[model samples]
Target: MSLENNKAFASVLTAGIILLASGFAATMLYHPQDLEENAFKIEVADSGAEVDAAAPAGPVIEPISALLASADIAAGEKGFKKCSACHSIESGGANKIGPALWGVVDRTRASVDGFSYSDVLNGMNSETWDYEALNEFLAKPKAYAPGTKMGFAGLKKVDQRADLIAYLRQQSDSPAALPE
Candidate 1:
């Protein structure tokens, strides 16, 4: 072949090779793996104990009142760091990602002016931020009020939640009475 034809042939060959390699790589990457026959097998309990698959996991949380009795406001202030990203506890504090929490304790739900609240919160317009309500909400925001806009993963430790709630109570002009 002439020099120009040879160059053209080489270029076509290189293009064809690249195309074939890309196709091979794509097939390898996109191919689904076959699941093993035992992939979904339920393991038999060796101890002869019955397992209830439908039962809820985790320990039942105690009432917030019991926890609040010994809640440490200082520790709660520290725990408030997690909330500071979204909330401002200072009186008359400007709303950030969340509504300012200056008087959140005992305050009506979704009552902040100018801040847009989620429909879930708005639906609870008659509800107050009482201790039990706050605890339940904090324990599992999604569970307490499904479709809540609060992104908190929920405080797992009861004491930490109490502390956080205490700190919030202190932020108010007139803090709500602690649970008996």
Candidate 2:
């Protein structure tokens, strides 16, 4: 090879070697440590203990009817803002990513005229959008209908779900009666 070509090749080879060495050094210095040392240790209850150690931890969910009695419509409207991206609750509102929810409270499931529904939801056509059903579905859409296309994570708070339901009920000309 010519002198000039030899010099250029050497420069490129040196640069590549430096980069490879730096990467190897970084990998060695930042190597991941064992996480077992920081792992949480769950305390198992004794055979005579009142609580069941195997039972999952979390608050017990109350019935939907109980929550609706104290639900504030105004707060629901505010919370509905999160849903506005995919749903339109106004009467005669056009469907967005989700079907229009104007009269969804008592309407048949997956009955929206032009909107496409997931196979899971369509199969549930016999069901009505009653308070209890709405409560369960709003709490976790994927859990309620495993193959549902709705990407919403669901409302975690019972009060928020009740408020949202209340606001939806108001959108209809003849709202469904609250659960007893």
Candidate 3:
């Protein structure tokens, strides 16, 4: 090949290599995994089929009441470090990114003054945060309250949630009684 043809071939080869490498790197950086279930479904009006709404797919969370009796408050407090960035567990503590959780265990949901709660949570203001409620919420925040602004993905472990609840229960001046 002539010197000019050689140079041009080299440039084309380098460009082709770069293109292939970038495409491969992009795929590696963003691995698109197949979802276990459909994220959302739109029902066809004329399908004429009964569509039973199914719960989101995940392990069935066992109630944490039995776990709370023997749950380690110290470990729970340790777990709170992860939550401290968003919540304040101290009595009379000001709200951070999330509402102050000082007395959140049995407190009314979305009742914290001055802290803006999501519409979904505001709708649930009448409800109280009992042990079971906290358990479920801790396990999966989004699943419990869809469209909630709380960005925490949620603690996945049952024991971790139970312990965290135990610690939160102590943050109150008058702690709510543990579930039997």
Candidate 4:
């Protein structure tokens, strides 16, 4: 055979060998399981059917006062700086990007007049806002209300949320105390 033809054939054979070795090595090294075949299976017994799985245990939440004290007013105030861009806490202040937040604490959700609210907030048939509910909502907006249009991402730190709620409480007055 001509030298050129021999060299070309040798190169092609070498390439084929490399490809075959690579594919075999990969399959041997990583024997991936077929999820559709075996991963999803149902077991039946004479008594009944049973399924087994594992999930992480959820965390135990603490009280609002303890969380707030841990966060401190200063931290909450700092956190509020971001909110100041769209909201105002001064009593009777005009609504800006968002509504005036002067007396939001303990007030009914979406009860503010004139300002429009999402259906989710308006649909909530709740009496009044409380510390625990406020904390959950602040921690994660969408998670808490599902369809709220507040636009705020959410505060991760529980203490920070408590502090913010505390700050709101300070700005607003409690509902008129009922007389016996």
Candidate 5:
């Protein structure tokens, strides 16, 4: 082969060798490993098949009505920062990925104007955002309403959920009275 041809072939071979070596080096430096357990776990409900009547299902969720009376609204506001990404809590706020949450406490489900709601939430025209309803929904969104478009994994802490709900109540001009 000509000197020029041999030189080009050598350069191509060297580049390929360097690329292969870098790939191996990268794998060694940053290898993936299986997690020991999931960082966050979500509960999914059973299908339409009937469950054993006597057998108690999953963990029993405690009602948060009493907790709301003393819920730390400040802490709840802090916790709700994560939700602000998709929702706007200010009065007359525009909708984003999720609907505007102004006056959401005690508001009817899927009642926000100009926001496209998921079929799951839209189907609940008769439902209201009552304290107990919010508690159960925030505890486990998917379990509360299956096929919901909401992606939140649901807060595991009852206190945190209560606090958030309390803060939400304050956002409205006329907050609904706490449950009896």
Candidate 6:
């Protein structure tokens, strides 16, 4: 073919290729959801179906033996700062934002004098502040007794919770009377 004719032919071929490519690009852009829906998928088992055989029977509260043995009163005192915003640890202390925490370690949940608590805490009258109860309550205040006035997000760390309990115990009149 002549040079001009050959160039014209090549130009038409290039234009056609470009046009084809542009059409494909435009279609893909406009129909992205369709491309996503047509993607390869693999089926997996639902995570909720798996049973945790090792899960504890009751709420995972810290043990009394471990807390009494290794309980650090200093750390507990430091942890008590969080509670100090609402509670008073001094013996025979009056109630504050929440109830005074004096004698609370072995005392009942909401038995403090003249201080009104939410129905959740009041409902726990029979429950004593033993190690297990304290641990469970401190781990998740709302979970232990729903609708409690104490708005604390329970201390997740077992050791820290233990420390706070120990510090509170020390502040009580009968600190030695607390279960070992």
Q: In what order do the candidates fall by TM-score, top score first?
A: 2, 5, 1, 3, 6, 4
TM-scores, all models, native as reference: 0.72, 0.80, 0.71, 0.59, 0.78, 0.64
3 or 6: which has the higher lDDT? 3
Q: Write the residue-wise lDDT of candidate 5 on 6-90 in tens digits.
A: 9999999999999999999999899799999998885556885988989886667789999999999999999999899999999
TM-score, candidate 3, is 0.71
Which is superior by lDDT, 2 or 5?
5
Can you tell me which runs of candidate 3 are displaced by over 4 Å? 1-59
Q: Which window of ten consecutive residues has the lowest lDDT sum in model 5? A: 39-48
Tens digits of per-residue lDDT for model 4 on 1-180? 899999999999999999999999999899776666666565322242543447432344455756554546666777889899988888888777777887776678777777787787788747566777777778767666666667787887777787888777667656322112
C-alpha lDDT values of all predictions: 0.86, 0.86, 0.89, 0.72, 0.90, 0.79
User: Best candidate, TM-score-wise?
Assistant: 2
**Ranking, lDDT, top scorer first:** 5, 3, 2, 1, 6, 4
lDDT of 6: 0.79
- Residue-level lDDT of model 6, residues 1-180, one tens digit each, is 799999999999999999999999999889644464647675333354667779754555657647665789899898888888988888778889898887787787679988998987777788878777888888988667666777788899888887877787788777745454
- Per-prediction RMSD in angstroms? 7.9, 6.8, 7.4, 10.3, 3.5, 13.2
Clash counts per candidate, in order, are 0, 0, 0, 0, 0, 1
Clashing pairs in 3: none
lDDT of 1 by residue, 18-135 (tens): 9999999999889787876766776332452786889775457667787776889999999999889998889889999999999999999999987898898899999899998888
Better of 1 and 6 by lDDT: 1
Point out where model 4 deviates above 4 Å. 1-63, 69-71, 174-180
Which pairs of residues collide in model 5?
Answer: none
Error of 4 at 30 (Å): 30
**Which pairs clash inside model 4?**
none
